[model samples]
Target: MKRITSFILLLTLIIAMVFPAPFAFAAVTQSAPTTEVPTTEVVTTEVPTTEVPTTAAPTTEAATTEVATTEVPTTEANTTEAATTEAPMMTTAAPGTTNPDTVTILHTNDMHGRLDAEDGRVIGMAKLKTIKDNVQPTLMFDSGDAFQGLPLSNFSKGADMAKAMNAVGYDAMTVGNHEFDFGYAMAMQYKQLLNFPIISSNVYKDGKSVFAPSTIIEKNGKKFGVIGVTTPETATKTHPNNILGVTFLDPVASVTAEMKKLQGQVDAFIILSHLGIDSTTKLEWRGDNLMNNLASNKDFLNNAIIVLDGHSHSVIENGQLKNTALLAQTGTALANIGKVTFDLQGKNATNITASMIKEADTKDVTQDEAVKAIVETAKANFGKATSEVVFHNPVPLQGERSDVRTRETNLGNAIADAMEAYSETGFDTAGDFAVTNGGGIRASIDGNKDVTVGDIIKVLPFGNTITQIQVKGTDVVAMFEHALSAPTIEKDGQVGLDANGAFLHISKSIKVHYDLTKPAGERVYAIEVLNKQTNKFEPLQLDKTYKVVTNDFLAVGGDGYTMLGGPREEGPSLDTVVRNYFKAADMTAYQSTELQRILAGTASENVPGEVTTETPTTEAPTVEATTETPTTEAPTDEATTETPTTEAPTDEATMVEDTIETVTTEQPTSIQDTPAASVEVKHDNVIPFDQAVKQKDKSQHDAKAQTDKETAHQLPITGEAAGTGAAAIGLFGLGLYLIKRKSA
Candidate 1:
């Protein structure tokens, strides 16, 4: 009976071992009952792998019983095995870092027209090549003013500049104001030579496409979208005639529209602007004049991360605006190279920084052989085209700095004299006075050697053409007065007149004087027109018109000379005049000639300067008699006694007309608006220049407000783990359970 009972127990244990009770259980054990069994009741332990069925009794009760108990031990062993196996799965990485791709961006700006090193200073194409070779997968860009600076750039009308840029492998470039110097025809010629795109969003020609506004370039599996914008003032401030058929659009609006169109398609957005840096206002329009509008317009700067600025010739030394955008510029004339690097991940630019590398710093770096060869070839070609003697100055020619402008500097005198001589060769109606802008002189004439054509070119880098206009004696005084008054004056007490106004350097004998202390319009209190036959200064009659010699830039009213553009006789090209001047002077010892010689004969003769102790009570003079007839001959005779015309109207309609009127204005024609004109001369009844400057300042202030608002929503979710540890643990447990069941 005991054996039977044992056998039954053994069968039950066997069935339980075979079935495994569906879930993990402890072992069942049997022990002698009564003598303090050590609480060892029959403990049945079920193994998860297989259930033990009691009905499947072992042939021997003892054997079955032992097997059931052994199975209980095996169940405990399985649980230990599961725990050991699951531990390693807890030690693996979360995800996503096994393989990664890296993208690098290399950038540069403001390469001007420099094609080679100048006097040990690296200026041109070679410098850019060195940078590109050193940095792999580099992308090169120019902010603007890539052409129109040196003689080579000028003589070829920027064709050489374009060819050189193409040879150097520029990826893209923006149009600068200076591009208009040669007119749109030359611009198109340059465009044809370029291997890359000429990008400018604001300039439109012929009511159709002219140049590409933006271009997307891909390198190393990364897409970079570049947009370009020239200053809006280009249409009016630059060559109006060249841009006559084209329209200059607002930069902010253009960029905004472009960015919106390119939104998710590009990995990064970059703006190459000819609009100089605005350091004073940071995000405001301080330097390039576009900052005020750009800062206020949110849509324009939306996704743009960096701006490569030019035109102001400033340098940004490691600074950022609004903590997101960075601004950088290389000082003008290719003195420095600007470099910026972008670190990108997938489609986002994760980091950015910039530096200005001066030629001094890059001097030691090895020159790129390929770029050096291209420069040498260009130099040889430029040298072969012209052969002429150039004058030189031992001392650096000083620029006009004082408020009383002096047009006849050693440099200005030289250039003016050259132009006067050059023009007479072709046109019998040669000009009397030679005029040039103070800004055109780029370098000082130094050293004792004879100046070569290259030396002259270095000083007069902008290839401005000489032009002659016929103006009345009365109009000349009016133009001179306009240049001397108000905003034209420098902070210093000195008069800010250029040589044409301050000294009146003439090819033929002429005399003029001004009362220093007198208010602007009254400063030219005494003026004289000389009869070369008599060689004596005489009072200028209001009605008599005079033939004036100047550059084409001024004949077309360049540099706010609206009076010069009005009905006047046109003479020979200004370039011809300047070249003739140099030839006539036959200046063998270039350094010996001083600029003072030009003004030696025109010193003010009025003793102690005549001062009206009290304001003149005399009524305003009557309208001066002047005609718009174009003449080919110079009048040697002088006339007297003409009254001035009535004051011009100051209404907006008139002002707008004045803004766009033709370059010629005879007798200050009542300051009436002329819609047909292209330039508005503020000399008449327009708002003061100071007030205009103030209005520009206000626009910049509003732009900063928009930048702050757009970046407001991107607060970082920093420290929070992307996934949780509990979720990982649960996944591991499930995996382990599946493995165990499959193995069993």
Candidate 2:
């Protein structure tokens, strides 16, 4: 009997080893003991893989490649993919979709008080609010500089903007330099009006935060920590008196401290930065500097996710920093709005996508009733003076700051001409020249458009009064020297022209030939005064005192021009001065004498002498007219004239033309609620994190690399666990082979 049992066991062992499928099935029914392999567990594993069987092949290949290249475990990728697939299965999903874990952020920056539509493009605040309501889980945020641009907001010292923002339901906003335009008290007043939080980690007064340093917002059970930063340039950029006691801290230090404060408290860290993208390019301390500085302290700032930036009027849809944070900046004047979508699972972001919506494309969008009412009311309040037609422009006027500051522009000439003509009419005396700072002319009139009081207000939004002052020719030289003396900031990697508001835009009565290549005071190579008496051009007399026309802002030492003493006496509102001038003067096509008044040349070589008293000259129109007897003709709302030759003078004119594109502002009779037709993803700008680390500090990178290397070398699982997993896989494969043999 023992011999017969041994033979049977040997025969069974051979059968199990060679063609064991039948035996394996029989063995499973017999249930040997605890050592027997569980067929049910193997089947359960197969069922999970079969659910998304099609994705498995590609996923495995991708996983293998990632592991080989990164030398890191691919478990995170697998977990993220699984979570993304399950996103659609949420119970309390976002409206119209099943993505509860995902949230949308609707953002704008540098709206600059653009309450009304322009060129039928800008959607205005009303439409923005409408769009925000439709996008589920959306948080609306403004990065700052929403004050002090349009007449509707500027006239009220930004109160109107505050009202509109309140109506739009802005979650938060940062402080911008323009916020201090009316002064700190007014800014605080506006802040009080806003329903949303005004936060800035950097700005301080008496060592206390000017506003809330950061705020914690909860949405759908997720905690978000948002910190704000303002530009350090606010010190010199705004009116000196406006921010008297305020101190702007370094953005890097402020952000780092905020990170520490909010470290364990929030799921995400977002920065509302008025610091723009280009620093060296703009010659200002910008977002790039902030990011670079933050990247230096990688250990502390690893949690920062996004930065909503402003201040340079830039458009960056998906700008990334070396610290693995995203940045979005919409262009100024509410021209564009940024949208960021974050898919968070648990406490970490699984995915992030960003894009910008252009206001011009927002034709389909509707205006929210509440916000529409607020905007309409604000416009109506300012409409009496704003809506009346003042003059007409046959050709487009260029009043862009960069153009007017860097060289002579037609809009500058027109404004100066009005000031000079107004000084004569209001004061009964014509000055030798009229000067207005480029910063004062904020907007330009579109060609073939009716110039309205609203248009003039937008251009000269400051409401400065015309001032007639008398200063020595030597002082004139000093003022001009000071005007151009403000050193040029960085522009496109080169120092071109200073962004100083003091850059002067002179009247047609004086011809200034300057060499920007030369140092500040030495830039003025020649100055000629158009003698009203001789009707001829003559060299400026340094010792002789001449009557000068300017705005009260400049006369009172505004923008570092103390040389031009306070206005002799207030003459008329600057907008009114220009309005009255155009009303009386002929509505002829005004062709800008390109490079005639302010000629840019080299100090080594004087501009080709064009001033010649040798030939008889035509009398310049008398700017001196008694205030009682207005000299201007009847003003027409819809005035048109024949187009004149618009060609520039010479090669020099070509250079200016190529450098500065003409800027024109077109106003529609009514504001339109333009909505974006579609959105286009501007490709991602991924900062090479490792390369950035290396560039920042070799020692830091080396230290980080050594740690990473050590971590990577360590096994993700214990040897026993890995061996058990391998043994299970081997047994499963062997079972499959035996089953196939038995079937054959």
How do the predictions measure up, each by TM-score? 0.58, 0.64
True-structure lDDT of candidate 1: 0.46
lDDT of each: 0.46, 0.58
Best by TM-score: 2
Tens digits of per-residue lDDT for model 2, 460-564: 765556778889887887777777675544444544554445678887677665657777775665567767675566667777888998876566455556566
TM-score quality measure for candidate 2: 0.64
Which segments of candidate 1 are over 4 A away from where they belong?
Answer: 1-110, 219-222, 236-241, 277-304, 342-352, 390-408, 420-432, 457-465, 481-534, 538-542, 566-576, 583-744
In model 2, the clashing pairs are 283-490, 361-675, 361-676, 362-674, 362-675, 362-676, 363-675, 584-632, 584-633
